[model samples]
Target: MNWYVVYTKPKWEKKVAEQLKNSGIECYCPLITQIRQWSDRKKKVEVPLFNSYVFVQLAESERNSVFQSVGAVRYLFWLGKPAVVRDEEISVIKKWLDTSDCIDVTVGGYQIGDSIQLESGPFMAQKATIQEMTNTHYVLVLESLGCVLKMKIK
Candidate 1:
C-alpha cells in the first residue's frame, strides 16, 4: 500500500484521522502541543501539525475508501495524479518531531500562502508558493515543476 495525501475540511484533520482508524484504515495525522492564550488564561492543546492534511497508506484500488470518513474531501493532487508520500519521508517527519533539536527561526516578511519568485539557484526566476514554514525547512510548491520542495533553512 502506498501513502497518499488527503485533503480534509478546515480544522478537521484530527477528527478525520480518528474516523479513519475506527474503520480499520491506516492513517497518520501528526499533532503538536501548542500553547494557546485566552483573555483569562493559557493552556496547551494538541493541534494538527499540517492544517487540513492527513496521510493514509492504502492500495490504489482502495483509494475511494477514504471518503467514508467525514471531512475527507479529496486526495491532494500533484502533476495530475494523487500526491504520494514516500515511507522514508514519513519516517523522517516522525523522527523530527520526536527529537528535541528545534532551533528558534525568525522568518521575516514571507508567510504561508505567499507567492515568491526565486532570484537564484536551480529554480531561479521560477515562482513558488510558500506552503508551510517549519523550524528547519520551508515547504514550497513549485507549480511549474509540479513538485514540493522542503528546503532546509539555517
Candidate 2:
C-alpha cells in the first residue's frame, strides 16, 4: 500500500485521523507540542504539524472507505491522480517529529534573490525569494502569494 495525502476540514485533522484509525485504516497525522501563552498561564499543546492534512496508507480500493470518514475532504491530486508520498519522505517527517521538542530550520549558502522552498508550516512547498537578511532573521518575498514575511532563523 502506498501513502497518500488527504485534506481534512478546518481544524479537523486529528479528529479525522482518529476516525480513520478506528475503522482499521492506517493514518498518520503528525503533531508538534507548542507552548501557548495567555495573560496568566502557558500550557503545552499538541498541534497538527501540517494543518488540514493527514497521511494514509492504503490501496486504490480503500479510497472509498477513507472518503467516508468524517471530516475527510479529498485526496490531494497531482498529475490528475492522487499524489503518492514516498516512504522516505514519511520517514523523515516521523523521525523529525519524534525527536524534536522545538524545531527550527534554516537554509544557508543562499544568496540574495535566490529562491528557496519552505519545507513545512502553513507555506509548505511554496517558493519564496531571499530579499534581505540579518544575523538572526530573514526577509522573504513570496511573489506568487503577494506577501512578504519576516522569519527568524535560529
Candidate 3:
C-alpha cells in the first residue's frame, strides 16, 4: 500500500480524515496547533498542515472504495490520466512533511535570466531583465525602454 493524495472540499480535511478512519481506511492528516491571540485572551486551534487535503493508503483494487465508501474523496487523477500527481513529487512532499513543520512556503523574487512580468508600482506591466538580486529587491533593466527600475519583492 502507498500513500495517495485525496482532495477534500474546502475546509473539510479533518472531517474527511475522521470519516475515512471510521471507515477503516488508514488516513494521515497532519495537524499543527497555532496560537490565536485576541485582545484579552489566547487560544490554540488545531489546523491542517496542508489545507483541503488528506493522505490515504490503499491498494489498486481498493481504489474504488475511496470514492464509493468515502464521500470526501472528490476525484483521483491516476497515471497517464488528467491531473495525475507524480509519485516522486508525492514522495518528496511526504519526506519534507516528515522532517519539517509542514507550513506553506512562498518564495518571492526572480532568478537570473528569468523573464519577469511586473505587476505593480512604477514598473507596472513592464518586462525587464533581472540584472541583480539583493536582500529584498531586484534590479531590473528595461533594455528597450532604456530605463532601470528597482522593484522590491516581498
Candidate 4:
C-alpha cells in the first residue's frame, strides 16, 4: 500500500477522512489547534493543516472505493499520475505536528514584488504586493487601495 493525497471539497477534509476510515480505508488528516478570536471571546479550534486534502494509505486496486467516498473529489495528480507521498515525509509531518504548538507551512518561495494576500486579519481578503522585507518585518503595499502596511513577523 502507498500513501496518496486526495483532494476534497472545501471544509471537508475531516469529514472525508472519517468516511474513508469507516469504510475500512486508512486515512490521515493532520490538524492543528489554532487560537481564533472573535468579538465575543477567543477559542482554541482544531483546523486541518492541509485544507481540502487527506492522505490515504491503500493499494491501487482500492482507488475506486476512495473516489466513491463522500466529499472526496479526486487524487492529486502529477504528470498525469497520482502523486505518491513517501513514508518519511508523512512521518516528518506527524512528528512536527506532534511537537509544535504553532506551525507555519510556506508553500512556495516568495521574492520581492510577489503578489500576496492576507489570509486572516482585519485586512482579510485584501491583496497586496511584497514590497520589502527586513529581518523582523514585512512592508506590504495594498495596490488596490494605494495603502501600505508594515507588519512585524512573529
Give all candidate RMSDs, comma-separated.
7.1, 5.8, 11.8, 10.1
How do the residues 1-154 of candidate 3 rate in per-residue lDDT, one tens digit apiece?
6666677878888888888888899877767678999999999999886677677877757866666444475554556442433344455445644664333322265577777766643334556787878777667776533336554555
Full ranking by lDDT: 1, 2, 4, 3
Instruction: Give the C-alpha lDDT of model 3.
Output: 0.64
Per-prediction tally of clashes? 0, 0, 0, 0
| C-alpha lDDT of all candidate models, in order | 0.83, 0.83, 0.64, 0.79
The TM-score measured for candidate 3 stands at: 0.51
- Measured against the true structure, the TM-scores of the candidates, in listed sequence, are 0.69, 0.72, 0.51, 0.67
Residue 57, model 4: lDDT of 94
For model 2, name the residue pairs that clash. Answer: none
Candidate 2 ranges with C-alpha deviation above 4 Å = 101-108, 112-134, 137-152
Could you tell me the TM-score of candidate 4? 0.67
Pairs of residues clashing in candidate 3? none
Off by over 4 Å in 4: 100-154
Between candidates 3 and 4, name the one with more favorable TM-score: 4
Off by over 4 Å in 3: 38-40, 68-73, 76-154
lDDT of 3 at 57: 77
lDDT tens string, model 1, 55-139? 9999999999999998999999987999988786677567656766644434469989999887654455668899999878888
- For residue 69, model 2's alpha carbon misses the true position, in angstroms, by 1.5
